[model samples]
Target: MITLSAFADEISPLPEEQIDVLARHGIKHIEFRSIHGKNVLDLTDDEHAQFRDLLRQNGFGLSAIGSPVGKIKITEPFEPHLDRYAIALKLAEFYSTPRIRIFSFYMPEGDDPAIHRNEVIRRMTALAGVAEAKGIRLFLENEKGIYGDTAERSHDLVTAVGSPALEHAFDPANYLEVGQDIDSAWNLLRPQVGHFHVKDYCTKTHKNVPAGQGEGQIPRLIADAVAHGYKGFCTLEPHLVVAEKFYGFTGPERFGDAATALKTELNARDVSFA
Candidate 1:
């Protein structure tokens, strides 16, 4: 029963029309990226409350707060990031979402990866302490141009943090971006995975494609996670919203195309979205 969700950012800026689109597509859960076209830290209390009310009225639940917490240089001290995390936690409480997506940020130029690695673990652990007390889980997503881009590094960072509050948000296409085989990457990060991102990529061009149309081996990835007993949401972060220049279509058209492809794939594999 892996519930399918989508990022609000994919739909962009929380428009009323987007809610209608999501409702039409039967998308009941969303991981909010930002509120009122700003980061979570910048959202005021009134805006947060209004956002929550909108979701409630629209029959949507906030799957997680997609906070850009700590997605900066590792050399930068943790204090500034901590402030943002605190704000994110408050918003998470307001929205009644139990999870937040965080990052390992970029490694500083000409610095030892080892030092940056330790700093990330230390900072994440401190954040995890606060999150644990607040009853929230911080999920570290592997992204390109970041220290934890690969399965191995992300696993090591999670191991070093050693907090139950900290877990992995697995994204296969991200591994593909860094030139890792999706199957091997999944095997490496299987033990630490707490959530998932559903996306696909063109192996040669490194471009995003519809979920089942790329070289990501999505069926195998989903099967592996199911076999490993991953009982969490497989949220769709479809980067397929960019239209071809020649076609002059909008982002939603691309997203709708991707959604159709994903629905077909899931049907063929007997994976029910509900």
Candidate 2:
């Protein structure tokens, strides 16, 4: 069955309210972005315990920890980031989640893509080693302005890492952000995709749009993944709603409008957790 999970950030930083909204929407799974008023990697043990308990009581599964683990400079040494990854792995174990979402660090201008790419693979492999020991999967998400922005680059990174613990958390909208063809991107990364991110974007205006209303071929992307035997959570990452706050520096009212629009689009697609 295709289970739908919402990205907690879509509902903002309020856990209690987020949980209530998710339950109202019939969503039983969630990919958490932050915890205890801190990034996932910065959560303390007590925070982790409380978070785990809250989700358990609500009958919600922690699908993955949206860790900002590797979304730094690719030139920087891996040791500092490894420490963050350690914490994230521990948190995942605490929550009993089998996976964590990661991002490829941004490479600076004039930097050699080849050199940074190799470094990314090396660092990811090391992180994968930690995940292997903990029996967890490290899912790399493609993001604009990052080294692994395109599916081809993501595939190369994973292939170079050469660890089964590493997999792709495919986000089609991110590809659209960088002007890559979404369908081709899906074809490139489908084999290594362990999870899915349901999002959409508009390239002409460089704006994030609600699912199914933008250039992202969401239905076709899902169909392609299903054709490839992907039976995993089609995680709803309503980034278009949150992008204003995080990117455009918009207000809460904007978030409310975007969320309502998102819910409407999801309904039109006949996509629901219930």
Candidate 3:
């Protein structure tokens, strides 16, 4: 089955409220991003223990750790970021999830992403090494304005890393945002894609919209992924209420609407989700 998971913090900053919203929506897996207004990477040890225990008690399985492990600028120092990743790995272990969503670092302003390609690959290899050491998989998301924004570059990064710990997460809307076609994206990265992010790109506004209501062509992608026996999470990254660079918020109603919209596409294809 194609399972559905969500970055629950989009519903609320409070962990309790996040869980409540997921329960109401029948979402059993969480793409743990934040809780109580703190990023998953910044959670205190005590906080981690308490929050993880709560999830265990509630029977919420984790689909991935939505860590910003590689979301920094290409020019930023690497040592600190790698240290931060240690914490992310700890969280993944705590949640018992093998996958962690990540990014290839953003390029310097006004510089062609290609200029930093070699550096991006070097850093990505290092990041993949961390996941490989910990027996975890890194799901590299193709975000706009990053080194791996295009499917082609994303494919290159994962290929260069050459580790099962390194993989891809296809966000059709993200590809559209960067003027990359979904067909080519799916063709090139299909072998590497571990999952999808449920959001659509708006051609007119150049913003994100609910799946299937915009330029993402989400339904087609879902059908193709399923046809190829891609069993993975369709993680909801709905930026419905507000969109920003670092993070976004959908609130309860908008978040629920986003989930419903993606579910519509899944159901249209006669696919089942957990």
Candidate 4:
């Protein structure tokens, strides 16, 4: 229960290298973010073929399309991004996974996120409709500065959308970064969490860290999730090397460290997992 997966591209941009590193850690699943230094959404038809071949040859499975589908400026045009989301949906279908990780659009600097709520809801509802029609599920990640970044706003989006196709992808580190109360956040978001992300943030150093070693409250959350009969993929977004507002990086060694740290936390919770 509570199986583990990772954004393997953080290990290396090269798909083959990413696979090799994951295999060494006994990981069979990866959040398909990028391969060969290209974003997943940017991959061409030929590239998709090659990516599939590599995954098959290496005995790996995809957890979700780790797409930057809505990581755009909120004030920018929406039509183009909706088209991009269509591409992400196709990729998810092609990879045989209903899981697709996405974000609400980022708010313009110093803009009140609440002011954009109506627009965010409209766009999210549209995307949810597409997923429902196509038999896929969308996991909305709570990235900072986005309209749905906070736990309350995140719950609101899921509630307002009123669709099973759309739900939450819980990330404790992200919550902590915004000074949210984890207990309250968990209580509110728990019912809607479709997937979990593994990462930790150090308040003291203000940097990313391995799970269970910082302000993420990972162990407590894991125990609670399992106690509540929750079982699903906990996608690793280690951000070990170069975590920025938009992207992150980590090599094979650091990625392995990140995976091990998460495994350690799970083990302590007496949770059986890969």
Could you say which candidate leads in lDDT?
4
Off by over 4 Å in 1: 110-112, 241-250
TM-score of structure candidate 2: 0.88
Ranking by lDDT: 4, 3, 1, 2
lDDT, each prediction:
0.77, 0.75, 0.86, 0.88
Query: Which residue pairs in candidate 3 have backbone atoms (N, alpha carbon, C) closer than 3 angstroms, thus clashing?
Result: none
Candidate 4 has a TM-score of 0.97
**Colliding pairs, model 4:** none
- Candidate 2, after superposition: displacement of residue 120 in Å? 1.6
| Tens-digit per-residue lDDT, 85-122, candidate 2 | 87787778777887999988888977767767667777
lDDT of 4 by residue, 97-182 (tens): 88899999999989888899899999999999999999998999997888877999999989999999998999888888888888
Estimate, for each residue in 140-229, the C-alpha lDDT of model 1 and write its tens digit: 998876889888888898888888899999887788887887877777878888888887888877678878778888766776677667
TM-score of each: 0.92, 0.88, 0.96, 0.97
Name the 10 consecutive residues with the lowest summed lDDT in model 4: 218-227
Q: Which digits, one per residue and each the tens of the lDDT, describe model 3 over residues 1-274?
A: 7888888888999988888888888888888899998999888889988988889888888899999988999999888888888888887887788788999998888998888988888988888887898899999999888999898889988998899999898888788878998898889988898878887878898777888889888888888888899899988887877778888888988888888888878888898778
